[model samples]
Target: MKKITVKITSILIALAMVFTFVPASVVATEDVTEQTEQQEQVEEVVTEEEVVTEEEVVTEEEVVTEEEVVTEEEVVTEEEATTEEESTETVVFDDINHWAKDQILKMHAKGVVLGDDQGKFNPNNNITRAEFTAMVNRVFGFVAQAELSFTDVQGDEWYAEDLAKAVAAGYIDGYPDGTMLPNNYITRQEAAKIVVEVFGFADMSAVEGNEFADFAYVGEWAQNYVAIAKEKSYVKGYEDGTFKPQSNIRRGETVQMLVNSTGEIITEAGTYTEDFATNVVVRSADVVLEDLTIEGDLYLAPGVGEGEVVLENVVVEGTTFVAANANLAGEFATVVVNAPVAVNIVEQASITNFVVNNKAAGANITAIAAMVFEPKAAVKVNGQDVVAGSKVTVSGGGETVVEPPSSQDPIVEEEHSVYEFSFELPTEIVAEEDVEVAVTFAATEVKDLGYENVRFAFAVATDVEDAEVTFTAVDSEGTEYTFTNEGAWGPAAGFAIPADYTAATDWTLNFSKAGTYTITFQLVTVDGEVLVEGTQEVVVLEEATIVEEHSVYEFSFELPTEIVAEEDVEVAVTFAATEVKDLGYENVRFVFAVATDVEDAEVTFTAVDSEGTEYTFTNEGAWGPAAGFAIPADYTAATDWTLNFSKAGTYTITFQLVTVDGEVLVEGTQEVVVLEEATEEVIEEETTEETTEEV
Candidate 1:
């Protein structure tokens, strides 16, 4: 083509030389200059010569087609604007940081786009037809509506279904020869057309302003779609003020455009109740919502800012995550139920399968009236049954309290038959005393399936060494159980029963030392399934026996339940000498010593007589005898003692009666404690002189 142009220009220059006599050579030079300039215009035309050559033969029609393509190409120039090579080596894509950063990352996180096997996004590489079609299918979850027979798309190919779906969705079509050419790079205009169809934006009017300088290059058939995309901010022109319509769309740009069309990018704080029926992305500011229902997961995204979400009567079918650094606040019923915190069914709310986990601590879940149905056995607060109408305070992670179940509440238990056991014991028993207990166990016949084996387990709790438990009609077969040595110690013990055996057994127990003792029993089957459980209590009393040489006086005392360190504890002893025969016994005194665990605490005691006399005693013993107060000869029942501890620990306050010979007659001790921090009154008393000396 260049040779032909050069020859034509030479002939024109010679003609000009012959026609003009004005220095023929100079005239020829001017004509040649003009002709050369004209030839430069033709040579400037640039087309993808490689594509034409790949098609091979050049017929008359092909030549004309090439000229037209060259003409169109001549108008476009390599972009002169220096594109900033936005760097993001930290992002999934090495070159994904410019206009496509937000959109690319957003879609990547949504699992909508994954880079190549090399983990390179290759943001500048043109996306293949298959790649673009797959992205469109993912965005809309479109399925193939009909079979596709594209010559280039095989049934077993990876992108066959995506191609079929694209065709079914009326977004793409095969060539005249039934070839999809899925591996072929898709153009910007082609992508715009598919995106418009998938997003249902075809009905939208074309945006008025053709802001792109090269907008005229866009095919007439794709102008409307591209215009809509530009208006919606889904597609943007280069900084050079041109939208390269015929340019191949890159993989990164394709995903970015797809995400932009979805409108999932939230930039402000507000409740979204658009009924997405799928996962909702939460970005941006704090949000508050009520009565909103989401059919899918709710994600609290990162990098958005500090977010506080409040949900009221909201329902999420999928998981709801209040990610770390984010705060979720709301009542149980309105919050995410079935999570760490169980839902609250307040007042007339129908009962559902309920569970109270660690999250239930400080959580409210009570009803104004009885439940319509009973909750499941798993309904518990820290592993304990959460009785209806009871408040739960979760402390120390697992500790919890369950108030007695209301009598008006319905019972929730399996309808399985099991043995029932009961025990009866005297409530009051002296220390170092023996006690007897009668137990009754019964199991009704379940029509059939008689039990083959039954067991009874018992445990004794006390600070005593010599203890015994014996079952009267003992039998291994028709077993009558017994324990002669120290009954099983620790928290519990187990016992067993035989098949078809039901009887009452007398359990004799004895304690050699003093302290409170409690006996509990669990009746279970051979398989270790608990049938019935019961507990019986025996308070082993500690009595002070006075020597016959001195007069005897019996008295009881009560002290402060709690005392703080550095605080004065007023302990008023209300006593009367029942037998005041010996004037020596009449003059009673008091003493105190630190308990073994807290013997290091420096405790002091001051006793005051009724007539206004005070006697102070220093803490001087390590769990030993410490001298205390001596009541006046005319001392009455009203005597007060003040105690102060320098450290926190348990202490024993002992009361002693002195005879005339100055011999200690009888003494009794009770336990007391000092807390870590000083109490309100203790702080005040430490700072002031006035003290409230009350019992």
Candidate 2:
């Protein structure tokens, strides 16, 4: 993003340079020089006063006196002539101290307004409609001329091109009778209407009450525009509290109104790093803007075709218009459609309010992620009201999800067969830890009622890269099923729930990093038709303490790194006797726990001592005989264990030393791989060899 500090003065300078006009001060200086030369000639005439006395004797006393009076009259007349000459040579307005003097001069320097051929700027004179149109056209750079058909505006008229441009720009229109009174003086209200239209300020025309004492006298057609102009400070009421809207507007007043409504027009492709005190028109694309505050409306003009405009850390205090087929990225206050163009709200971009006006009936707004609309935000299309949570396709992202306002819960339409659906997740959990989420589902009327494929589908989306989710459910026959997805939607097959089931609860989520996550679930049919769906959010907090630092004791263990599925493999886990005695407890127990990612997978550990005694335990709990395999605390030798896996997947085995009070003194985890069951051919070969040996 390019950074440029553009002051309001710099904008005026740029505008002046664009039009190649002489400054009003320079014009004033030339007028002063001419006046000074005239004064020197007057002085030279005064030096000739002695010659009058030298010629006194040529005539009688009365004649000499009459000549003297004539000479004095001539001197006064010459002075008057010099004053007139000075006025004619003055290129600036006579009202140098006028209230709108600065604006008028600036407008003149920008070539938006001009003085007469006699070098007189009649500041207080009424401005004609043609003149106002020309000023507005120049201010907005509206050069595209429309074909004129007005009876009074011929092609050869001085204001013909300007009227054509204003008409083309859709700001000014002729009378319905096909006549444009070009030379007629435009009223204040009429100029206000044109100013509003030229600046695309119609959205702000909604006013609360009459702000002017004479507002009732304002033309009905121009009332709203007058209100908007007053609200925007482009026009003001008199000190007497009346907006003389019916009175013809003066040329200086017109300049002030136009200047108030003017803004910077960005015509080139580059970054703009200046805070704009007024509106900004983006006429070019491939522009990056940053760290700037725009106090007025922003226009993504139609000239920016198919190009991308990026706004970073930019704040717009007024409505924004997307009139181009452009990609926008960054934050915006309010965005409205002006053209029927496809607007891509790329990643990281957000719009506070989005409006699709009648002129942009088919405007397309697409976003990379779900666009959440504020509750108070107005989103309308072709004058029809559209609520928040309207589905929008998520390109280059996950499933399309529309988050409703937080004040209301998402209402599942009654048309969906599975009416009761909810996702219960912990609002906050420690990161790098496993957490359980409860899922409930019930169908009012199940489609394909007896189908076994009818199940629940779930998806987990998070900023954390290593986040994972597991779905577990139990059937009517006590058969447990589990499914796990790495980062996205789980199990293309989904988790099958019994047809008679209601509110099945066991689901698990694990986060490897601290972040926010969204969990979405849907009751899907056999053919993947979503019956009902809901989404919930969870916040994962960073772990307060590391596991190792919190452990009371430290120990090491060993187990089989790999094993075959459905097979019993002999494995031994050894813990140092000295480390156990260090606990100084008369009685303690050995704890083993196992968990895996395989669907419906289970692990069992059977302890075998030197005396050939065997004890069995499942990977269900920790610390006691009822929870896990317990070993005698006095045992000073290593214990051997047999492990068996029901399915092929990655498994985690945890070894812990704990007291009878169930306090773990030490704990460690080791990863184990459960490979697929041995091939049937190997078993057949072994059987054939045994049969042959017996034969």
Model 1 off-target regions past 4 Å? 1-99, 265-695
Task: Give every collision pair in model 2.
Answer: none
Deviation (Å) of 528 in candidate 1: 67
Best by TM-score: 2
Best candidate according to lDDT = 2
Give lDDT tens digits, candidate 1, residues 1-695. Answer: 11011112121110000000000000000000001122222322334551233224333333321111112111211121111122122357554533344446655554566666555565445566776666655554443344554545556776766666666555665654445677666677777766665444566797587656887887887788778767655566554566677766665556556554553433346665444444454555466545666664454433233444445555656445332123332222212222222232333222222333222233333333232322222344334555444544433323445555466774433244456667777755554455667788666543323343344556767656654433333443665445643232111222333434477776666555566667677764422355667776666657645534434555466777678888888877655555555443343344344453665567787775545666676763221124434543334565666878887877776665544445666565777777899678756865675444431
**Residue range with the least summed lDDT across 10 consecutive positions in model 2:** 17-26
Give the CA lDDT, 0 to 100, for residue 606 in model 1. 78
lDDT of 2 by residue, 1-695 (tens): 11112222111110010000000000000011111111122212222332333223322222211111112111112212233234333448653333344455555655567766556556555666777677665554544566665546557866777777766666655664446777766677777777676667765645668577887887777778777777876665554567767766666566656555655556567777767777766766687778788888887765565676777767787888777766666667788776667666666666677665545645656656345432222343223344443433343442344444345565333232345667666656887677887777666566444333345567778777866656555655666766665221223334555445576576666666687878778666423356567788878788754332221344455555447888898776666544333233335666778877778888888875566666787775443344444333333445666788898888888887776678876677878877786567767977999999999
**Candidate 1's error at 26, in angstroms?**
60
> Model 2 compared with the native: what TM-score?
0.39
